[model samples]
Target chain A: MTTTEPGTAEEPGRAGPSRTQRLVMGGAVLLTVLLVGVIIGMLVRLPGQPPAPPAYDSVDVGFAQDMSIHHTQAVQMAAWERDHTTDPVLRLLATDIEDTQHGQVGRMLGWLELWGAPTMPLSGRYMTWMADAPGHDHREPGSSEPGVTQMPGMATAEELRRLRESTGPEMDVLWLQLMLRHHEGGAPMLAYAADHAQTPQVRNLAAQMLAAQTAESEYLRELLAQRGGTPLPL
Target chain B: MASGKTSKAARRNTPAPLKKNSFPWGTVTAVVVLVAMIAVIGTYVAVRSNEQQARAEALAPFTPTAQNPDPSRAIPGIVIKEYPGGSHVGPDEQVAYTESPPFGGTHDQVWAACNGVVYDTPVRSENLVHSLEHGAVWIAYHPDRVSGEALETLKSKVTVPYTVMSPYPDLDRPISLQSWGHQLKLDDANDPRIDQFIAALRLNPNTHPEPNASCQETTLFDQHNPPPYQPAPTPGTPGARAEDESVDPSRPMQTG
Candidate 1:
């Protein structure tokens, strides 16, 4: 038991607060300082909020995987032209296609690594991610199988064969036709990613691909027209 | 300040009653968690830095190979013929040549100055022999390979004789061979024929496509053409193979 004065009881302790009161006040100050320090540290450490965690199953991933496949075929076709065509302009274009697409493929693989995702998704149905997209028919209009039709402008086996067999001006014209269609197919995917991807890096890359492909597509159209051909109706 | 005083007093007392309020368990717990989180982040960064350093170290050995220089550098002087027919370049005279094709003068002519006299020849295998006979070291942008039979013929025809100082060897880059044909900076330029060969070797099938008689002219870069007509002239310096010794003339041309 300790001595207590009547006025001191009201005051809590002699000129100072009691041990309990002091402990409570000190604890409160310490708690505030720690909380503030933590918040400041974290805020300082935060890196632009890290472009919100990418959606695991997203339009962005689908676009990257599918477009990579598309670009691979384009590269293969371009390589064929480069090796076989005698036309200087066509050979130059083929080389450009091969070098640029190979670089883009590298970028996509890098993104997949950073996202901790597989290069391709475990989807039985390709392009199902775009079901909600209006005016985005991927098949011959009124086809029943939904996403079964080759996604817009893809060449069939026979078309690739014809490309390989023909040479000279005929080959150049056919290659330009097929490539222009392939770009048309690819443009929508890029546009979707540009509008919807969570990462600014992803969106910016998509926009760049869009601009480049669109310009190339226009050039192809002009090349075809110069050779007395027109773009095939989708 | 209060907490410091209370804790001190509690330590001094034999048995202190439990304080109504002491250290804030919530604040202490939060500070501990934050510190742990920061530690984890620091460790992650350090590990990543080490991995990058290790990767750079492992890729050091596979760099590309360099081009080999001409190794033959010895020859003896014998005789030389002057232009319009033949004359001798004295032992003290020099050779000056270029890759430029001959139009009016010997643009592609092989010329030598020896004993204060000048000798000139078309850049033919026969001329190469004449230059060597003058004790001149022959260098060409593109040295043509003479066939084994042709080399023998050249060896027999050479009048006042010398030796091959720097004979053509295999090269790694085809472009280097073709490009070198354009360079005429070395003393071998002292020969007049080398300038003619340089001009002839510049023809490209794509640029002109139709092969001209002049276009068939040879240079060292044209490895596919043929072997040296005779064994390469033996090096004349000490510690070198004897002049009677011979090099294989049928070695396969290295395809770049």
Candidate 2:
């Protein structure tokens, strides 16, 4: 055996670094791993925010519903001209009206279904859905004079009767005149729906209706002028 | 004896019980991390599935199609989703026909036939006829022979100078009273042919009538207008007759 110095010889029980040092190193490694994990987790989570559901209550719903009904009537009157009128161009014009309105009605009904709502909302009043309209003051249901309370541009009972009674060119001219007014009433509501509806589908369909009806209105005006008739004062 | 005693002492001292790590720290940590990831991903999938189910259930009750709301209008709104066309070989064999407005039967049945579309109800038939008159054809039948028969009959019976061909004879609708050179109107109550066509058509209870007063008029069922009004063939003769150009507004055919 050789003589050993007091300090140079290690304690038999101690083999390496002290426990504190080992702990410090392990902790450092753990911290680095945790830090990297957290950064990756944050990056992975960033894109997860969901889109919001379309927000609408009865107002938007009512416009789509009621306006669809209004358009149907207009379609009916236009169809009458398509059949009885001898004019080929007029007949073609009526076809356009029917086709466009058919599409519009379908889309509106689609919205009601999408929203988990009833087809005919149980609202008591007509145009109440438009109550918030700025300065528009649509006629309240059942409030106006008995006769004039008819939806705007709707033909009077007498006028419809006359249209039924007349034949040939007379029927043709009157039908066009009445339909022009009917569409005139529809344009404003279409504009409102376009601007205010909550759903993109609703707004898009409304805009299309507005554009189509407006164009149709122009055509009807020109047609009336050609027939030596004027637009019925709304 | 001294050496033996030293060994015994060494044995009695015993090495400290070797430490056994009862808690597998590394493996436990790995398992915990894996479990956490699974939990998070499972939650995400469940949420997504729930949302999809909600959307599907919401759309389930209302079936959608390209059908017109009014059935009577010419363009019945529904059409066959697909069709293929071939080049025309000759006018006699031509499949293309002029369609009038209120375009109906253009392609296919909306629901029933291989090639027809049906609109929802409330729209009247007169509207459909008017559209047809204006040159809109509701694609009625596929271009196959059986489907082409009605079209051929329509061509022969309704157009002026009626000439019929085989494989598609003129189909007489006693209700329509549509024979060679004449077709019944929706409103004409007096035409024996129309009455007959009506009687035959009644076999199909679903057949809809054109709405309103104009149904009384003598409708030209086929789109072809007469090549100027030729005088009727002299009694008991089959040769050419005189022509009358004047519009006889009063002679509108009445069934009553």
> What are the fnat scores of the candidates, in the order listed?
0.00, 0.00
Where does model 1 exceed 4 Å of error? A1-15, A18-28, A36-47, A137-149, B1-256
Runs of candidate 2 with Cα error greater than 4 angstroms are: A1-56, A139-150, A156-158, B1-256
C-alpha lDDT of candidate 1 relative to the true structure: 0.46
**lDDT for position B94 in model 1:** 23
Q: RMSD in angstroms, candidate 2?
A: 17.8
lDDT of 2 by residue, B20-87 (tens): 13223554675566567656656767887898666544532221112212122222122211111111
Q: Could you give the interface RMSD of each candidate, to one decimal?
A: 21.5, 18.8
| Candidate 2's TM-score on the B chain | 0.24
lDDT for each residue of candidate 2 in A51-126, tens digit (9 for 90 to 100): 3333334556777657755665665566667767888888998878877775676676566545534333222234
- Candidate 2's docking class is incorrect
Two-chain DockQ for model 2: 0.04
